[model samples]
Target: MTSRFTELSVDCHDPERLAAFWCEVFDFKVIDRSEDSVEIGSWVPTVEEVRARQMPTTLVFVQVPEGKAVKNRLHLDVSPIDASTEDEVIRLLGLGATRTDVGQGPDRSWVVMADPEGNEFCVVRSLASQD
Candidate 1:
């Protein structure tokens, strides 16, 4: 049987703040919080809401003493639901993301950026605008 994807965990120096950054990025809300970790996901109005019906995986930020030493081998690529790629990139930059160069060169279709904690992710054209 194939395994289903559920959560993506990120190690950071500050779980709460990092989680908050990601929450704003994805319009997600905190699902769980602990001393060393915080989990964020798409908004769920009630406890009885069926998590099995959720569209995407949850993000978890775990506190660690060490900082990120190298580039992420696996990174997220996000498409704006309502904004253009350039607008979304600008918005993210305002929220503490900084542009990064991962050797994608000058002709890439996506913009690469790093979070407050230095994890790289991409902003791409939305599916509706891709046609």
Candidate 2:
């Protein structure tokens, strides 16, 4: 079988702060934490579940000495489950996210935003609002 996309590791200056911000962004729970890292997802899975690839993808924030210096080559694209894109963007802003420009011009459907740690991501229109 092919490998599963299980976890995304992010290097940051403060794991706890980034973890907290992301958890609020996605309503994720902190499944695990260590001295230099924090893992957040929808739930805490057992080793068996993880090995079987039955767990949802999780984000792991690790402490690093260097700060983010350039635009992200890879980023996450998210849609709100129960809100309009504008509302979701407003909510994310309230949670400490700031709008960012990565050459995404005014006509694009997705809005670019940066997390507290300066990682760029997108908020796209929800399916519920499209029809």
Query: Candidate 1 — which pairs collide?
Result: none
lDDT values for all models: 0.87, 0.92
Model 2 C-alpha RMSD vs. true structure (Å) is 1.7
lDDT of 2 by residue, 1-131 (tens): 65667899999999999999999999998999999999999977676777776568999999999999999999999999888999999999999999999998899999999999999999987855455
What total of clashing residue pairs does each candidate reach?
A: 0, 0
TM-score of 1: 0.87
Highest lDDT against the true fold, candidate: 2
lDDT of 1 by residue, 1-131 (tens): 33446789999999999898998999899999999999999853342343444456789899989999988999999999887888899999999999999888989889999999999999988654444
Each prediction's TM-score against the native? 0.87, 0.91
Off by over 4 Å in 2: 51-54, 129-131
The true-versus-predicted C-alpha distance at residue 39 of model 2, in Å, is 0.4
